[model samples]
Target: MRLIAFGESFVAGVGDPDHLGWVGRALAGRRAVTLYNLGVRGATSTKLASLWRREAEARLSDEEPCRIVFSFGVNDTWHAAGEARVTPAQSLLNARAMLTEAASLCPVLLVGPPPIPDAGRQARIEALNENFKLLCARLQVPFIDVFRPLAADGLWVCEAAAWDGAHPGAAGYQRMADLIAAHPLWRAFTLAE
Candidate 1:
């Protein structure tokens, strides 16, 4: 299996002390497969939509089972000049196009954006999460809602707040990895041979 994890800093494991981020922890001990972390700091869904194909194609193989995992939106929710980096509507459109193409290529899973310390930004992140959920449902893709759970988690909140107010520490990343590990969809996908 070859897995390509696409998104922004969160997917890149920015604030974690060990630097293994959630993606690394989640794939730990799974030496049978090749994993590529294509996450970029401060990247938006628009960037992901534009770059994922080229990135994934470089690592994908015909004899291997390919999979894609997407987690973004925190950057999209970021505001500049009084407007979001990527509007909710536009975010949905980008996700739709990306997921549609990714699904056609291989199995795909989406992890909704995690929460930030800012209430205003968190609100935008929440809205994006809801939209992502709906889009994933309509597309029949597996969607994991990480925002609500991590939003209320003390470790995630405190660690992220103490750090960059966005990315969390090792404990928080572990929590995220645990969540993904326990998700039924993730289990089903990994169980496939």
Candidate 2:
């Protein structure tokens, strides 16, 4: 299996001491799966949409089964001088475009943005998460609501707070991986014959 995880720093595993991030931890015991982590720091959904096809194409082949996992939005909701980096409407458009393209190529999983320490930013993230859920439902794609679960998780909150207020450490990443692993869609996708 060939898998591509494309998104922002959270997907890149920024704050983790081991640097595996959630992607590495999630794919750890999956035998024979070649996974590529194309997560970039500070990337928005628009940036990802612009770059994903070209990047994914380079690593994927027609002869093999390939899958894509997308996790972003926190950066999109980021405020710089009282202005958002990417507005919710634009973010949804970018996500739709990327998911449409990716679904045409192979299976796609959408992981909603995780929580941050700031209430204001987290509010934006929560709204974005809801929008993402609606979008995924319309497209019949599998969506993972990482924000809701992680927002309430003490370990995730503590680890993220201890570091950058956005990214988390190894324990938090493990928690994320566990969540993804337990999702019914994830199980079915990985265990399919």
Please list the C-alpha lDDT of all candidates, in the order they appear. 0.89, 0.90
Best by lDDT: 2
TM-score (all chains, Cα) for each model:
0.97, 0.97
56-145, model 1: which lDDT tens digit per residue? Answer: 889888997889999999899889999889989999999999999999999999999998888999898998899999999999999999
Model 2 — which ten-residue stretch has the worst lDDT? 184-193
lDDT of 1: 0.89
Which residue pairs in model 1 clash with each other? none
Model 2 pairs whose backbones collide: none
In order of listing, the candidates' clash counts read 0, 0
Clashes of 2: 0
Q: Which runs in model 2 stand beyond 4 Å of their true positions?
A: none
Q: Model 2, 1-193: lDDT tens per residue?
A: 8989999998899999999998888878787788899999999998998899999999888887889899999999988998999999999999999999899999998999999888999899999999999999999999999888998887887888898787889999999989988888887766533
